[model samples]
Target chain A: MTQGMSLIVKTITRLVTSFITLFGIYIVLYGHVSPGGGFAGGVILSAGMILLLLAFGREQTMKIISHSALVIWDSAGALAFLTVAVVGYLAGDFFINFLSTGEPYRLASAGTIPLSNMAIGAKVGAGLFGVFLALAIFRPGRHQEEE
Target chain B: MDPFMLLLLALLAFMIIGSLIAAETEDLLSSVVCVGAIGAGLAIIDLFLGAPDLAITQVVVEILCVAILIRVVLNRKDETHRTHKDTFAVGSVLLFLGVLLVLGGWAMTTLHPFGEPLLAGDQPGVAQQYLTNGLQDTGAANYVMAVLLDYRAYDTLGEATVIFVSIIGAYVILRQRGKLRHDTGNESDS
Candidate 1:
């Protein structure tokens, strides 16, 4: 019964994190219509990552998700966002809309808004995961010799 | 008195109390908490005065500032006041008080908000058009997002760069500073 209970709990945690990540994607995608946008969705995605970190050991998580990759993701996300804004600036007034205003409430709508939200989500999720790894893995007391 | 006047008075009273507490506290942590309270009081004033965005920004910024300051203090040894010189300090305090009085008097007398709303509904004004047309034009739900990402995007990019730089700094500081006995490939030969 105890083993079964543990299995159930593990499954629940995995399911919950998956659900949260999916919801985060939805929030970023539908940010044009909803209260939740890039910033909020990014935080939500980070929360999902935090859950994964909790379920899996630090070593396992680090093996799958490296710090270097997070750094690259953060940089690339920010650069993409800046590039879009610059393109808008060069084409029109400062930070003006350059892309076509597609049919409203559609998947491909909001021109650069959806793309910007995706950038934000990527930056925030990776940045927050980096913070968590720093805080969790680099705890002050434990030494390498202990291993 | 009007509701706004009452709210202003309450906020002012809270500020005075928080300032008194912050001033009396010798413990740096306690003083920081008191300052945080003052920030919250100011945020409440912003909310009551119909500036929700400013209130949210102020709260987040204040929390970040306090957290960063506290973290720095934690990493340092117990600090002692090294200087006893009071001449310049006394003059500076008096100068500050004088400036504070002038600002307070101005605020009390002014009927309108201190600054004009830079962004308003669309009327062909330089800033207003962005706010008015942002949702319709960009399909962004939040006007604040439109402004931050669309209008002031360069500034946002710069801010993100600053965060990345700080992360690198923190990683360096938290890493082993002393020379390792075994030269890892990660380290330079020098």
Candidate 2:
């Protein structure tokens, strides 16, 4: 009975975590038309990562997610955003809408805004995950020291 | 139900969840995380209400604050060591605060009067025009960027100066002035 209860709890947690993660991605992609944006979406995504860390051991999680990779990705994402903004300035004026604006309220529309949002999403998501990993590293469990 | 009603429901739900988490968590760090989560939710709600400026600022500031807290908590020696008395005291305090909050919120709901659409206009107010026309005039799509760069360029300059000043202050406090002094055997004998 105890084992069954534990299994149920684990399944529920997985469901919740997956839902939040997918929801976060939806928010990041549809931010311009909806309430969620880069920051909120990024944090929610990180919450999923945190859940993974809790369910899977820290070592297993770290095997998949490296701090250095996250840092590099975050920096690159930020640089991409800055590059686009700079490109706008070099082309004509600062922050010019470089992409062709499609039909109003279309997914393809928003003219570089969506791209910028994606860049921000990447940066924020990686940055936050980095923060959590750093925290875990600094506070390893007692069993870790013994090993 | 109206979209506004839905938003209000979400906000209220968040408030309740935050209160419950804050109340139930015996660990200070977990309570702080709950508070941070609540703050992030509030910021999202603000964005939905068409206040991106406030939302961005809140999100960034809160993340930095949480990062600092995480750093501190990780470095601390004690993770969990709470007596029954401490738990009781914390729980009682949380309950009292929650009740007081509920009363205040109820009063606010009753006393508050809805206002007209302050932003209803064709030409758009100074703020709106700045958001719309700033891109055309100064060529920036990010509404915040347009506002900060063209309409409020002076303010941006001031903020940049402040950032520079803070950086210098930090360097002054943290930078090493001299090279490390090594003690060789001869030097120690001398």
Candidate 3:
């Protein structure tokens, strides 16, 4: 029931996939200096993955990232984000930026925020991809009926 | 009316037409496309309102949504049954719309003026503090990001947790098995 898209779409997707992924990474990394942040960038990242999933089909996409790995990545991203927050407790605050903040507007600035953003980006990207996979595939009922 | 207001009105009319098309169309594909059009229109409106972040998010989210919805209808015939118009249902809907319109008009009249700050209520100093001292405090060039990731971090944590929880919920609901075949019951996951 599931298959890759048309040739035109596949060709275009091949050209556009890397750009989307890079743009998403840029958004997440430069969040403190730009209009986007963790959530927005993460959503964009997932959008890219979803694009590949749609164009290449579930079997091929699964080859890139298996179902269980996605689950672990999703949970791990969330855990890393939470760890960032928890780490601040050593400095006597719930979410303190304990790390030394670099010069403003610099790529490596914003204390602990950049790490948090990357963590969130990973969590959101993986979580949404997993959700899409669950919805688009793994149809037990349909498989049984086909049998 | 000012050019901004006029342009906004035009976009609003476009969005309304798109919505109507989506609602009235029998072809589910066209209906989904109309919804995408509406989303694109709304993103343009967001740009007019001076929120590029929101506009960007809206555009990408709309792309994702349109793709998913198109996949749902692709390669599938429209087997949905059509129901004839029911006067009673139509009347009830119209009555509800009337009530909603009246309430919306009242709320608009009482709401903040156009181009004015919507959330600068009694505690206007909060946003002012963020705009002024956000850089020194958080070293973030973007005041919005500073507020979100530094000043209001607990809220961000809550949001991330909520996303995780919801994703877990979806995973649980979409699980195809109460227990996997050829697997012992000893494997446990929460």
User: Highest lDDT among the candidates is held by which one?
Assistant: 3
Give residue B188's lDDT in candidate 3 (0 to 100).
50
lDDT of each: 0.68, 0.62, 0.85
Model 3 misplaced regions, further than 4 Å:
A1-3, A6-11, A140-147, B75-93, B118-124, B179-190
Error of 2 at A131 (Å): 0.6
The residue-by-residue lDDT of candidate 2 on A1-147, one tens digit each, is 232225565677667978978987876676555445555676667767766665664675677777667677666666666666677678776666666655544456556556665666677677666666665654422222311
Q: What is the DockQ of each candidate?
A: 0.31, 0.06, 0.62
Clashes in model 1: which pairs? none
> What residue runs in model 1 are displaced by over 4 Å at the alpha carbon?
A1-27, A47-64, A86-96, A105-108, A139-147, B8-88, B103-124, B177-190
By lDDT, the better pick of 2 and 3 is 3
lDDT of 1 at B81: 68
Top-TM-score candidate index = 3
- Model 3 over residues A21-78: C-alpha lDDT tens digits? 9999999999888888877788888888898998999888887887788899899999
Question: What is residue B82's positional error in candidate 1, in angstroms?
Answer: 8.2
Clashes of each: 0, 0, 0
- Report lDDT (Cα) of residue B132, candidate 1: 62
* Candidate 1 lDDT over residue span A1-147, tens digit each: 232225566687777988888987887777655545665576667667766665665665676787778778877877777777778879976556688757666667667777787887687667766666665566564442211
Docking class of 2: incorrect
